[model samples]
Target: MQRYFETELLDVKNFELPKEIYKHAIVVMRAKVGDHFELVTADQKVHLMEVTAITKTAATAKEIEVFEQLTELPVETTIVCGLSKGDKAEFIVQKGTELGADHFVFFKGEYSVAKWDDKKQKKKLARLEKIALAAAEQSHRTTIPTVAYLSSLQELTLAADEKGLIAYEEAAKEGEKGALVTLLKEIKVAPKETKRPKLQAIFGPEGGLAFQEVTALEERGYIRAGLGPRIMRAETAPLYLLSSLSFALELR
Candidate 1:
């Protein structure tokens, strides 16, 4: 069954699919009346839907069952990377979304090989956003991660309740590995009214993050953490982090 994230499914029983979703449901998927699919609404609940009607240009579905479940990371994660050359950003966003990242952020690092100017920033973000949406749906995620850019590393900041990390290759060289382990080993507790804690980790581009850039971010409360003894490519590091997080936060 196909799954879509819909923000307008509240207090409603039946509705026409959005234009994009209509095309996918009616034309692409060849769904007929009485067919079943899934919808994840703003509340993050999964609803089983039955196709109620279908026209050449439109389709409608009705929710018959709602499943209250959690399909997100125990802690919200934001993947912040220095802009890279080529399609690395898209690859990162796609795989990262599937692996349960809550947000994706790109910034200009002191050693970044690519740059997004004011003229093309919107277009770049749009492409990444599309990839994230597809990956989220394919991965059966209830929420789609967001993509955004920062003008510079200095613009990156975290809330007092959030944890921030910088994936500095040098940390791995110096055998500094306790920060990430400690973070993952500790227990996280929150009241029903509050949300899980958030984590935002930064990765460098091809040449890796400059020491000075790491120093500046450290001042903003970002701790330097090592992924492992074996260094990873710019695009590979974020996925590694997401997998480790899933192992500790989800599987454990």
Candidate 2:
């Protein structure tokens, strides 16, 4: 069944699908009256819905069942990456959303070769947002991950107040390991009255982070950690970190 994230589904006899969703549902998917799909509302509740009626431009659906389950990460994880060249940003956002990232933050690093002009920045971000939405829907995620742009590493660090880990290549060279596992264990346990803890991991661009950049981040409470002994590209590091997190938190 198709799944859509809908902000309006409260106390309504019938809910109208948005224009994008309607076109895909009716024309693309050939959705008809009595066809079933899933809707995730603003309250983060998943509801089974059936198409009640179809107009020329839109389709209406009614809730049939409310699911009593959730499919989110145990800990809210955000991946921050330095802006890289080519389609690496899109690749990160798309795969990261499917892997259960709560948010994606991109910042301009000192070593970044690609620079986004004002005109290009808006278009690029919109495209990335759409990719995240599509990935979230396909993955059956109740909540779509958000995409953010940061002007600098300082802004990125200030925005994330949780456990911040920098994927430092130097750390890997020095044989640093087990930091992620220890941090995951610490955040995995929370009081009954508290929500899950948040974690943010930062990765550098192609040339990697400058020494001064690493020092600044370390001074701001960011822990230097390595994914493994093998060094990864700017795009590969975040995906690697996310996979490790899923294995530790979801599979274990």
User: Best candidate per lDDT, number?
Assistant: 1
lDDT of 2: 0.86
Candidate 1: clashing pairs of residues: none
Work out the TM-score per prediction.
0.95, 0.94
Cα lDDT of model 1 by residue, 8-56, tens digit: 6754467788898888878889889999888888778898999998877
lDDT of each: 0.88, 0.86
- Model 1 scores worst on lDDT over the 10 consecutive residues at 185-194
Which model scores highest in TM-score? 1
Candidate 2 clash figure, as a count:
0
Cα distance off (Å), candidate 2, residue 160: 8.9
**Model 2 misplaced regions, further than 4 Å:** 158-161, 190-193
